[model samples]
Target: MRLITYRHDGRIGTGILQNDQVRPFVGEPAMTQVIEQGIGEVADQGIPLADIQLLAPLRPTSIRDFVAFEEHVEGVRRSIDGATGVPEAWYDAPAFYFTNPHAIYGPDDDVPFPAASVARDFELEVAAIAGPDRTIFGYTIFNDWSARDLQSREMTINLGPAKGKDFASSLGPWIVTADELSPYEKDGFLDLWCSASVNGTEVGRDLLSNMGWTFEAMLAHAARDSVVRPGDVLGSGTVGNGGCLAELWGRNGRQAPPPLTDGDVVTLTVEGIGSLTNRIISGPEHGPAVPARRRDPARARHERQH
Candidate 1:
């Protein structure tokens, strides 16, 4: 079942998408609520998909983004280290970090390029919404928007991706339930292909099956010392080969492809999960400059920890 959360009748509504239309899941209230009830009984009335405005499937309860693709890691490392280098810890277990859930965007939303960035980029990823017993409730397209400059400069401090990534992350169009993907399943991997295009020009493509870590491993690791609750989300990180511009630039001898600019339309399509299309909107506004540094989000988080 393809589930959607959208605006209808002057208010937010939820429904199951079918045949280019939405069948409202009336008693469920929201996808998160319906998730709690279970995915077995999801049926409702109808509406044309073109009529309603959509939002992120649901504001996920919490989000954990895991780097699970070795090919992607090698691409990035080769760029930075001039040779491919996989971190030792990653070989032992899946690794991930928390991100701001508040910055999510729905399909068709216009993303204001985070002001502090010059090298604005996108990470192509797949995300799973949490369900009972650490299982996946469903999957959605995740565009992990990134500010390369800020991310690299901060990581040198040995801690942080704060301002670099916190600004915006997009997930949407709809969620494809796990059951719906069973036909495409193969030995714990989904036979799904993900590709991205910027302003109608194709930039990245990869198969979801190429991911090094499975959702089960990510969930198990995330829940090791804490609770993994309903409505939480976990990202598959970037897929193998070329999945982001940073990786692309890295692999291509640093000859940069055009970074996103105002009016650039970025569309990410996963053969089974559908697509999330967003436009980059430029604005004169910016957060405090990373160099100037008045307690930015990343720094603030660090200060509070001490």
Candidate 2:
């Protein structure tokens, strides 16, 4: 079943997505609540899916992004240093980051491209939202927006991607449950295809079958001692030759990074999960960052020790 987190009449809730209708799951707080409580009985009694304000499907405890696409990695590595091969460490284990859940946006929303972003681009990826508490429930489509020029410049300092990636990351209209898409495992392939359109013009497109590291492997590598709780998310890095700006405006292209202008509407579509349409509103004025409270220091310290 496709699960969704949404708000109706200013109240937020979770439900199952069936056809074009959203079946509401009463007594469930959010997707996070359901994941912590486990599935089965609650899912069986979900409400009908209809018109609802689809929020980010879950309140992720963490967002772990992995370098699952070798070509994308190789492409970046080569561009940076003329390196011919990927680093041994990059291949040894899965690498990820703890992203702000508050940074997440929903389908049909507007993305504020900060003025600091001179080169804005979109990355087509498959994002997995953990559902079974510490388990990878299933995969969904993701768009990792990037500021190519900013990222490239920061690499020289070797502290990388903080401001470059912290601004925005997009996820679904729904978090597809594993049982709904099990074929994604057996054949080690998914027919899911991805595409991006800016103001009705197609910019990025690729097949999900192109990933170098499978979802299972990425999960195993990410879960190695770290507990990926329900509502958490994992992104499958960009696909091959699918660099939004690297291939278009980086050294690979004839110009500098292609900067998105005001009023540009960028729509990302994945075959099964549906489309995420976001308009480019004037930065800051569009909306403030959803203020996330600072992490609790005592809890933070305990978590670190574990």
Candidate 3:
């Protein structure tokens, strides 16, 4: 089932999405309630999906985004200083960072243009939501929008991606239940293909099997001494070879595509989970310009080599 959170008749509620139609669950209207009770427990009332606007499947209690793809890890490192080394900690355990949950957008919403960003970007990924009994609930496509310039500057400070990443993160058209994707599993990885495109130009494609850390491992790591609530989210960072301007700008130096601009639409698609698309809107109206503009990246890299 494709579980969803949506707005219809001026009210927000959880529903089962199918064939462009919504079957709203009676009484238990919020997705959190359905997730806590399990998908099978919800009862339904029918509504045309066309009549309702799709919202994000649900607001996760918290979000943990893991850098679980070796290629992505290596690529990002190379993008920075051209190093191909993987941190020892990444191999021994999953590495993740918390992101702003309040900045999330629904599939059909517009992502506000981040004012401080010049290297506006999108990270194509898959996200797992915690469901009943602290196990997997379902999956959604994730667009981890970024401000690459700010990210580079902050990384040098040795603390965070901070304002660089908190701008916006988009999830869903709907969440496909784990059982719905189970048939695609082989060995221990799901064989689903994930891809991203900007303004209709294809950037990259990767398989979920390429993930270095599995969902179970990520969720376990997230739980440490705390709790992985039923509405919590776990992200499978950027897919290997996924094109965000940051990674591409490094490799195609001087010739890379321009960073995301206002009005550009980005789409992240995972085979079983469906596509999450959002258009950019320039905004925040008041913030300093991205600080990385002061440095010449190409010249800096040249200096490093000497």
lDDT of 3 at 258: 78
All candidates' lDDT scores?
0.83, 0.69, 0.81
Q: Using lDDT as the measure, which candidate wins? A: 1
Which 10-residue window of candidate 3 scores lowest in summed lDDT? Answer: 246-255
**Evaluation by TM-score, superior candidate among 2 and 3:** 3
- Highest-TM-score candidate: 1
Model 1 pairs whose backbones collide = none
Which 10-residue window of candidate 1 scores lowest in summed lDDT?
286-295
TM-score of each: 0.90, 0.81, 0.89
- 92-200 per-residue lDDT for model 3 (tens digits): 9888889999988998699985676787888988889887666888888888888877787778877858978887888898888889999988777888898888899
Looking at candidate 2, the ten consecutive residues that score lowest on lDDT are 248-257
Candidate 3 colliding pairs, count: 1
**lDDT of candidate 2 over 1-306, digit per residue (tens):** 787888877888777776666667767566777766765343454444444688877767678777666677776666544566677887767666655567888887787766756667777777877666356686677777776666777667876576667788888877877776665543676657778777887866777777766777777777777666666788888765544545443336344445676677777777766787776654653343466688789999999999
Cα lDDT of candidate 1 equals 0.83
Better candidate by lDDT, 2 or 3: 3
**Better lDDT candidate (1, 3):** 1
